[model samples]
Target: MTLDTWTTRLSRSLLVNGLPREYVCRTTREMADHLEDMRDSEGDDDASRRLGDPDTLAQMLTHGFRRQSLFGRHPFLTFWLSPIPIATFLAHIVYLFTIELIMPVVVRLYGESEVAFVSGSLDATKVVLVLAMHLWLQAIPVLLTMRLYRIIASRAARPWTSIIPAMILFLLYFSMTKFELTWPSGTNPGNYRIDIGTVSGFSSQPVTQGLQALFVALVCILWLYRVAGEQSSERESAVTAIP
Candidate 1:
C-alpha cells in the first residue's frame, strides 16, 4: 500500500482502539517520520515491511493507554451500570423546577407592563421559551443517553450487551415523560407541567414518542453497523497490504 494509505489506516485503527485524538496524531506523525528515515536507509520496499502493519501497531500502542482509566478499561460497568442514568433523571427534574420558578417571575415582572413594546416582547419571549422547553424536554434525554451508549459501545468488548438495554431504557423514558408549557393569558401567569409516568387518558403523546424513539434507535443502529463495516474493511486492507 502507499504510505498515505498506510498512515490513514493507522490513524483510524488508533482511534477505534480508543487512543486520544492528539496522541494519535502525534504518534502517526512520528511513525511517518520513522518510515521516511527507514526508506532513506533501506529504500521504499523494505521500509514498510520493517515498519509493521497498522492494525498490529495500533493494538500495541493502545494496549497500555487503555488500562490507564476505569472508563477505558471497563466502559460497560462505568457507563452502563453506573449512576449516570439516575443523575440524568434528577437533572431533568432540576431543570424543570428552575424553569418553573424563573418563568413565573419573568411573567409577573413583564405581564403587568402596559407599554406596547414590552407587551410585544413578552409575547415573543413566551413563544421562544415554549418552543425551546418543548424540544429540550423531549429530545435532550434521548440524545444524552444515546451519546453515552455510543461511547460505551465503542470501547466495550461486547457492545450489544449495553446497546440493547440502553435503547430500551431510552424508549421507556421517552414514552413515560410528559412536558407541557402553557402561554400566559391576560391577568394569568403561564404554567408548565413535567410528568414522568403514565397518565390516565387516551392521548397520542405516547404513540408519537414511541415512533420517535424507534426512528432514533434505527438511526443509531445503522450508524454503528456502518462504523463496524468500515473498521472491518480497514483491517482487511491492512492485512492484505502486508507483503
Candidate 2:
C-alpha cells in the first residue's frame, strides 16, 4: 500500500503488459509524485485510495501506451520464419566469400623466402577463423530465436502463438543447416560449403547439434515460466495488499 511498493508493482505490471521501459519508468515516477501530493494533503499512506490498485492502473496505462506494430503483431512471420534465418545464412556465405578473396592477397604479401612461414601462418589463421565462424554461425540463430521468444513472452497476450511455431522453425534450422570450411591446399583456394540436408552417411554431429539446440530451448522455456510465476506472485500480493 506504500507509494514505493505500489509503484514497483505498477512497473512490473506495465512491463508484463508490454509497455516499453521508458514509458513505464516515466509513468511510475509521475504516479509516485501524484501519490506523494495526495498523501501530503490527505495524510494517508495507502496509495490504492489515491490511484486505485496498481494492477488496474497498469491495465489502463497499458491500454493507452501499448501499440502493436506489424512486427509486434506478427512476430512469428516477421522475425521467426523468413528474414532473420535467411539473412543470417546469406551473411555467412558473404563472410566465407570475403575470406576467400582476402587469402590470396595475404599470401602474396609474403616474399618467396617466407613461403613456408606464410603457408604455416595462413593455415593456422584459417583453422582459427573456421572454428570461430562455426561457433558464430550456430550461436547467432539460437540467440536471435531466444531473443524473439523473450520479446513475445513479455509483450504478447498469448506468447505461445509466436513461440511454438518459431521454436519449430528454429529446431528445423538447427538440425538441417550445416557449414564446412576447407583449408587451402597447394593450388586450391580455400573453399566452403553450406548444406541444409542430411549428411550422406550416418553422423553424430547433427544429433549432437540438435541436442544442444533443444537444451537451450528448454532452458529458455523454464526461465520464462519462472519469470511468469514470479510476476503472478507479485500481482497476487499487490492485490491482497489493497484495502
Candidate 3:
C-alpha cells in the first residue's frame, strides 16, 4: 500500500482502538475524513515511516483495547504510567493514620486549645466521629481512581477526562458533608465531648476542614487534568507525525 493509504488506515485504526468497542466503528468513520486529510498532507510520508511495521501498528491499536495490563512491561514504569491507583491507595492510608490514630492522640496531648473547638464531652466524641467520616469520604476518590484505571486500560480511552468528572463529584460531596457536619455546632455524636473548659480559639473547625478539603481536591483535579491533557495531545501529535 502507498504511504498515504497506510497513514489513513493506521490513524483510523488507532482512533478506533482508542475508543470503547461500542464506539469503535463510529469513531473509525468519524476519523476517516481527518485521517485522509492527514494522508494528503505533504508530511504524510514521514508520518507513516514512524509507525514501524504492521505488527507494531497492530500492537498499538490493540493496546488498552483489552482489560489486561501490557504483559512484561516494567513494574516501575507501570506505577508512573498508571499512578492513579497508587495515589488513591496512599491517600486512604494517610487518612487512616492521621484521623484514626494521630489526631486523637494529638487532641489528648495538647489540651482543648490545640484541638478543634467543641462543647462539652460531646465535642470529643464528635471529633472522633467526624474523623471517621472524613476517612470514609476519601474512599470515594479511591474507588473512582480504580474505575478510571479499568476504563483506560480496557478501552484506551483518555483517562484524564475521567478525572474531571471524579473531581466534580469530590467537590460536591465535600461541600455537602462539610455543611452537614458544621451546622450542628460543628459536633458529631461520639464517645466523649470537648470538655468545654479546655477550649480556646474562635475558629470554626468545620469550615476549616471544608476549605482544606476543597483546596486539596481542586489541586489534585487540576494537576491530573493538565497531565492527562498533555499526554493525550502528545499521542495525537505522534500519530500525525508518523508517515
Candidate 4:
C-alpha cells in the first residue's frame, strides 16, 4: 500500500479504538512523516514489511494510549463516554432547531417589540446571553449523562472515578467549534452579527459551556467527598462504640 493509504488506515484504527484526539493526531503525524521519508529513501518493500500490519500498529499505539489516559483504571467508563462527541453533535442540532423554529413562533406571540427583537440584529450583550443560554440547554443532557455514569461507576470504584471521563468529554465538547459538526453549512449558534458595533463574532458559548460543566463537576465531587467522609465517620464511631 502507498504511504498515505497506510497512514490513513493506521489513523482510523487508533481513533476508533478511543485514543484521545490530540495524542492520536500528534502521534499519527509524526509516524506518517517518518514512514513517508523512509519510503522515499529505502523504497516501499522494506518499509511495508518492517511496519507490519496497520492494524497491529494501531493496537500497539492504543495499548500504550490506555496506560496514559486519565481514566486508565476504568476502561468501561472511558468506553462509556466514547460516543459523547456524537452526542454533542446531535444535541447541538436539536438546539439549532429549537432556536430557529420554535423560538420564532414563541416570540411572535409575545408582542411586536419582542417579535422585532427576534427578527432584528441582536446587540453583543444579547447575542452573548442568547448563545450562553442556548449552550447551557444543550449541555444539560450531557451533564445528566455524566452524573448517571458516575452513579453507575460508583459500584466499581469511587464516584469521582467517573469524573475524569466526564471532564474529558466535557472538555472535548466545549473545545469544538461549529466546524466540528457544521463546518460548511448550517446556522452557527454564535456566529451572528452583533448590532452594537456591527461586529460579527463567534460567541463565548464554549467558555459558558465549560463553566457549566465545571460547576456540575465541582458540585458532584464535593458532594461525594462529603458523603464519603460522613460515612467513614459513622463507621468509625460505630466500631468504637461496639468495643
The most accurate candidate by TM-score is 1
Error of 4 at 192 (Å): 2.1
Q: Estimate the lDDT of model 4.
A: 0.53
By lDDT rank, best first, the candidates go: 1, 2, 4, 3
Best by lDDT: 1
Let me know the TM-score candidate 2 reaches against the reference structure: 0.53
Give the TM-scores of the predictions, in the order they appear: 0.56, 0.53, 0.37, 0.37
TM-score leaderboard ranking: 1, 2, 3, 4
State which candidate, 1 or 3, has the greater lDDT. Answer: 1
Residue-wise lDDT of candidate 1 within 123-231, one digit each (tens)? Answer: 5666676556555555555565666665655554223334556556555555555555456788755555555544431174556445545654665566557656865
Over 84-153, each residue of candidate 2 has an lDDT whose tens digit, in order, gives: 4654565466446645664456445544233443344346665565455555555555555556565655
Q: Write the per-residue lDDT of candidate 4 for residues 1-243, one digit (tens) a residue.
A: 766666667766654554544565677678777777777887754435667788898888776755654555565645465547544655566566666775666556544455465555444655554565545544554555555545434333233444565556654454342311112233533234211111121254455335544654564456557655764564344323321
**How many clashes in each structure?**
0, 0, 16, 0
Which ranges of candidate 3 are over 4 A from the true structure?
1-97, 108-159, 179-217, 233-243
Candidate 2 ranges beyond 4 A from true positions: 16-18, 42-45, 75-132, 141-168, 179-192, 196-243
What local distance difference test score does each model get?
A: 0.59, 0.59, 0.47, 0.53
For model 1 the local lDDT of residue 1 reads 67
144, model 4: CA deviation in Å?
1.9
